[model samples]
Structures are given as structure tokens and as C-alpha cells.
Target: MRTDGGAAAVELTVHDEPCRDAAEVIDDGLGTANEAAAPMHEVRALQCYVRSADGQVLGGAVGRTWGLCAELQQLWVAPTHRGQGLGTRLVRAFEQRAIERGCRLGYLETFSFQAPVLYRALGYEVAATIEGYAPGIAKHLMTRVLGGS
Candidate 1:
């Protein structure tokens, strides 16, 4: 393809599965641009996990922190571990780490079928809601201040 009055050529490809190379290229390009816009934009992964006595994974929280903001990308708990407060613990651990990293706020998206109630109990307030995100479901965007900041 050509663009910008035919001054630049671009190629696009679709993959049937996850493409790490393509993702890396896109991440690199965006990272460079973001760094130019915000010199302090150093993103770092932050994760917390719970394990059973035999070292089996039970629950986890995955997120990233940049500047004063943290984004919770994923949270999961084994079915057997649900209702035992493991999810709450994982979230607390994740938030504590972000606080240690100097993050003042955190945000995440959760589906109606997911742990929106749990998040609310942990002080996350819904900032936005998307109706019909899935069949009979809604998506909620939530945010909270960490460490009273």
C-alpha cells in the first residue's frame, strides 16, 4: 500500500493466531512514540500470584505501571479457590506493589460476569460501563486511588 501522496509504502498482514513478532514490532514503535511524548514513560510489568502447597497456581493478577498510573490487565482465580478471598488478596498485593513503585492510581476493565463486585469492595469505582460487551453481559471500567494518593 502507498500513502502520504505515495511518499511512503506500508504492508499489512493478518495472522490466524498470536504473532509475537508483529506484536513486538508494534510495541516497539508505540513505545518509541510514547517515550518521545512522555520522557518518564517507563512501563514495567507487575504481577502477583498465589500457589498451593504443591506449587500449583491458584490465582494471579497481572498489570503494568507507568509514571503514576497502573493498569490491571488480567486477574484470574481457580474455580476451587474462588470464594476464599484469594482474588482479593491478589488484587491487594498487586496494588501494594504499584504503590511501592510510586503509582498513585490504578485502573482495570472487568466484565459483568467477572469480579466487578469484588473490585468495588476493594474500593474500585466504575468509571464507565459498556453495555452488551458480550451476549447478556456488560463491561465495566474501574479505577481507584492507591495509598491514599
Candidate 2:
């Protein structure tokens, strides 16, 4: 890429896989800009997992909390564990931790064929939706008030 004057050039490299260094750089840059814009810009990881008595991992919920909001990045339950309510438990646990961390709102993205119904049962409402995310599927951006806040 060249500047308007064509005196300077910049190179852009794309990676097939995740680049930790690039991620750190992006995080640092965003953190700095966000902190400059707001007082509550600190981000923290929040995760919840379910394990069996034999120590086998069953389900998990991964997310982050920043300011007054919590974002549920991913949630998964083992095929054999589906319909057992482990998903609900994991979500509740994740939300409980978020509430403890002072997050009054919860947000997450789910596919139409994924856990949108479950999230709705857990009090999440669709804030936005993108149709044809893949094939016949849709992407839903959901949100809910945590701890009645």
C-alpha cells in the first residue's frame, strides 16, 4: 500500500492461523484506546466448565467481562451431554461469576441451529440477527440483564 504522495509504502501480511504477537499488539492498541475513552475499560476473562466424576470435561462456557457487560464468546456441551441441562448450568455459572464481577448485562452470539432457544430460555433476547450466516442458518446477537440489573 502506498500513501497519497506515493513516497511511503506499507506491507500487509495475512496468516492462515492465529498469530499471538499480532493478537497482543491488537489487544494493547485497543486497550489503550478504550482506556483513553472510558474509565471502565479493563477486560477480564470468564470461563466455566463441567467435568465428570472421572475428570473428563463435559461442557464449558467461555467469555469475558468488561465494565458493566459480560460477553459469552463460546459455549459447548458434549454430544452425549446434550439435553441434560448441563448447558443451562454452565450458563448460569458463567452469569453468576459475571454478576460477581459487577457486570449488569450479558451478551452473546449464537447460530440459528445452535443454542438460541436455550439462551432465550435463560432470559436472553435477540438484539440483532443476520440471515444466511451459512446455508440455512442465521446468526443471532443476544443480550440479557444480569442479576436483574
Candidate 3:
């Protein structure tokens, strides 16, 4: 580490091991930030899975409720199941579950090349857009009103 014109320019080294366990640190940071944002509330994971006749998981959504919103962390379907409305069904079911858990809105982040159209068709509106993620790649943050909110 050295200083240039009184401005410190610190050298760095990459380590295979973490300085501390990341998960616990992240949880602690989240707890602190969430506490500052609002009174601590119980966060419930909401999900919906579609299975085959033999009970193989085919597609689903996973999300959790924070405050009054459902965070849509992931939604996916087997390639063989695409274009058949399974994605729609999964999203609908997830939103319904979020509603039951007292969430008044659904929030999700998606890449521009992904299912932006599908989410829009499901009544999600773009809350923010970031361009130039990598050339033509972009990121979209979307939200949908749930439970009449």
C-alpha cells in the first residue's frame, strides 16, 4: 500500500478463502438494513412447483416476502415445458401465495433478453431500467400490484 499525493492507493491480493463467512455477514448486514428500513417482520418464503405425473419437479418459482412486497427471486421451467403457459401458471400461483402472505406488491429483476414480455403480460410494470450492462444487455426492475394494492 502506498500514497500518491496524500491519496492512499492500496495494493490488494486475492485470497481463495473469505476473510469471514459471507452468508453470516450478509445476513447480519441485511438484518441491520432491514431494521433501519422498518420494524422487523417475519419473512416467509413463497413457492409454487409444477410436477409430472411421476412427481418430478418440472418448474417453479421461489420468492420471499419482505415488508409489504413479494420479492421474486427466481422463476424457471424446463425447456421442454416452455411456450405452454407453465411459466404463466407458476407466476400466477406465486403471486397468489404472496397475496395470502400479506404482500401487496410483487418485485422482480430480469435481464432484457429474458421474459420481459411475459412479465409485462402478467401485469408487471418496469420500475427502473439500466442499460449497457454488457453491450446490448440490460437489466430491468419490475413490479406488479398484488392483492388489490
Q: Give the TM-score of each candidate.
A: 0.79, 0.79, 0.78
Better of 1 and 2 by lDDT: 2
lDDT of 1: 0.91
C-alpha-based local distance difference test score of model 3:
0.88
Specify the poorest-scoring 10-residue window by lDDT in model 3. 1-10
lDDT of 1 by residue, 1-149 (tens): 43444667677667889999889999999988887888644789999999999999998999999999999999999998899999989999999999999999999999999889999999999999999656889999999999963
Question: Taking the tens digit of each residue's C-alpha lDDT, what string does model 3 give over 62-84?
Answer: 98887778998899999999999
State in Å the error of residue 55, model 3. 1.3
lDDT of each: 0.91, 0.92, 0.88
Q: Write the per-residue lDDT of candidate 2 for residues 18-125, one digit (tens) a residue.
A: 999989999999988988887754789999999999999999999999988999999999999999999999999999999999999999999999999999999999
Error of 2 at 84 (Å): 0.7
Residue pairs that clash (backbone atoms under 3 angstroms), model 1: none
Off by over 4 Å in 2: 1-6, 9-41
RMSD of 3: 4.2
Instruction: Give candidate 1 misplaced runs (Cα > 4 Å).
Output: 1-27
